[model samples]
Target: MTIDHFFQAAKIEGFQSPYDTIHLKIFYPARMPSQVEINREILPVDLEKAPFPVVIFFNGFNCDAQQYQWLAVKLAEHGLVVILFNWIAEVMPGIISLTPGIDVEKRKPTIYRTVPTASALPALLAKVEQLQSEGILAGMLDLQRIILGGHSAGGRVAIENADPDFFPQIAASFGYGLHTMATLSLGYEADTILPLPDSLPLLLMGGTCDGIIANSCDRYGISPGNATTPVIRTFQEAITGGRNDSYLLLLEGANHFSINQPDSTLKTPLLDFPATQPQESFRLLMGEIINLFIDTHVRHQPEASQSLEQLLNTPNPLIKSFERK
Candidate 1:
């Protein structure tokens, strides 16, 4: 609830106190049905600067825009413009029910219904472009340097939008297991998903202990029998065909819940996921890694690359890093 709780839950450390200048602005989609309008929140770094790199993040199933506030703030703190998007379908069942009877079991819930990755891209791109034209994003945002990332179901959205062919290739490369089960449950067929356009940079992050997704993939019978590498590899392969850069990182000892903000009382199960390091340590590690990843790739800061390399080589049994071919 509190900003401190958000940062702490995200495992952000080494700060004497919380930064107070993080600003938020919300944008409502222009033409979608009220039930389907997208909500975007912009968080700019507390410091003054011209044209920073921008990161537009999408949230996972049943999660609201705040789910990514911690990560977005972290990126903004490092001098990037961060935008968190809330998919209207994920939160509007009442409106969906009014349209026609919806099958909760057979059809994906409104929130889980497959959205064309392309459908949302233009709206998002236009928002940033508008900011540039109006001078709000002004010198601080480098229009050319943008990164897209997400978690759990949101991660699927990110990849699907970047390259629709991602899931099918994942299905084919990994075999019919957990990955397949997830694909089937989501109602995605190998033939229907599209490919990513040549313009966007992508980064895929997954936790070692991601129970829902990895477990689902495992139960369905995907390769590696667990959630770790197979999904990551699929994403790496999908983005390689585009001109944009791509990278996949596996946070060692981290579970799906750990990546989000912990509750104020810190009593949430998010604090208890099994990991080699204590929960806080792993969270901080993940935050730092994310910071470095955005800095190196989005901001074009060469020094950030060294930090990433050092973290990768560190003898942490829980972490793994890979670059797409």
Candidate 2:
């Protein structure tokens, strides 16, 4: 669904999940930034059909979950229940506006927060179960088809969580039949290479202009004049080392800020290249690519698989490179 359509759909009456104690803030993508505190809105879905897949998305470092609503909303429109959960700390409404004299550190995470990144998934899953038990998502969730996704620092969480070696203890704790079907990382990567098991899948999407994470000159190498990332190196290792379920997509002209909410205007040390395409177009492309990827790997939709194949084979202005092993 288009962004406008997503807003229209939100206006229609739908189930409003009760105060979610675990999910501090949730939003149904709107024309403006509007959040539903302690609750989540399940966009209009056909009740006669099977329940929708679940997507729990965490925001990048120093960014609010609402900044990624452009993505959460679109995913919901395309038949998934998207949950945008915030990290332990985020910018308040007041701080974002009183910015001219604000210290650089004040704009971002000022406190040293230490919630084990691995705990994010399990904590969220417990909250989801609580919501379901309370009839918020009763009979409307296909708990089997769950996907864990995140951006930047959040992406690191998803990547590390998917690896059996990183969080074996956490995985063992979730013996309640809940598992991450796949992991999608955007604008983030591990310091070392991490390859998923043959049964699980990985999709890594980042921008060529992402000066923050994509800053390594070569795989596992870094140079001062370069703006590449370790994600590329790790992704290459996954495919070459025989992880046949891995996939990677590089957005040509997109940047770290491009994936955030359109309303954001905070400045950063990262460079902002002149856009060759409209900003919203990039967000749409991101949503479309993510939707198709989830459908093919998580939902196992044949049509989505075909579409992904075409997008990879045929060159597009937006997609710099698409690869699957």
Candidate 3:
């Protein structure tokens, strides 16, 4: 678990559904890379210290992988092999332009229909197995430590699909099934009949002032913000159900778009809020805390355990409150 590692970037466009084309943007620790697409092109880095933990991150509705590059680089710096890909096909082009007649409610069912709740697990698992077998990523993947996560609609997908009992179709669909170590949902929750498997550790994170979706209040019954659907109920359900390993974080004065990157052209409605806190401040906070959380749960790093405890006890103004149960 070496924190001092430089990440090498690569873009491969093979992972896809039968009808859609999926592009996987990967970041891995490398001594050097033969070429750099976005940053710089360097020779291949020594991967003697390879087989890093995997994080399959799904982007929010209409958001693409490029939007989350900032967070991915930070995770890659800490010896994580991060994969960010476009899970849905239709949400694009429109998301970039904010065209007229764009409604989240109308778009959600499209997402539900296009994006399989559990198909991604087997698709990614097969892709990984193929890459490793061909020696392209021989020792660069740690499948056993995989974490499935996403934001907004993508987050809901992670939650709904992670239920092994509810969506057993994915297991039977593919020959090999994935055993995800944990699940992380950012600023969103699903309205699922089946709860997340008790064995799976879950992390629900959101902002108190998120005008898009209020996490501070029980907004399901009472409409207070732009979000018609609330996710706080999921947190309450997990906490009271005796899932001592689950956790929730509510960031103070942060909005729904705080963790997302602003498009230079399109005016995202979520970003229309007044800025009380610097955007990078939220990104740094999220990256650092998420890194520590993953380190504690995935790598079993004792230092992260101690640091998390210390940070949790020593309160800060940014974090309004947290429930670790």
lDDT of each: 0.46, 0.51, 0.54
Candidate 3 clash pair list: 31-45, 31-46, 32-43, 32-44, 32-45, 33-42, 33-43, 36-41, 244-325
Measured with C-alpha atoms, the lDDT of residue 241 in candidate 2 is: 34
Q: Model 2, poorest ten-residue lDDT window?
A: 171-180
- Candidate 1 regions with alpha-carbon error over 4 angstroms: 1-48, 90-118, 135-139, 163-182, 185-201, 218-225, 235-245, 262-276, 317-325
Candidate 1 residue lDDT tens string, 52-146: 55665655444555755667656655565666654333224333110111123332434333534323444565666666776334444567665
Cα lDDT tens digits for candidate 2, 67-106: 7777777877676666775433212433322110111221
CA lDDT for candidate 3:
0.54
Of 2 and 3, the candidate ranking higher by lDDT: 3
By TM-score, the best candidate is: 3
- Off by more than 4 A, model 3: 1-19, 33-49, 91-116, 163-194, 214-222, 226-229, 238-243, 270-272
Report how far residue 50 has shifted in candidate 2, in Å: 3.0
Number of colliding residue pairs in model 2: 7
Q: What tens-digit string does per-residue lDDT give for candidate 3 at 1-325?
A: 2222222222223323432445566766655433453254433434664677777676665666678888778888877767776544333444331111112331243353333344445556566655556544565676566766666655655544544454332210100001111121222333331234444556667666565453323322343453212445556652243645466677776666677687666445444455478878878887887777777876778999788778766778777777776
Give residue 63's error in model 3 in angstroms: 1.0
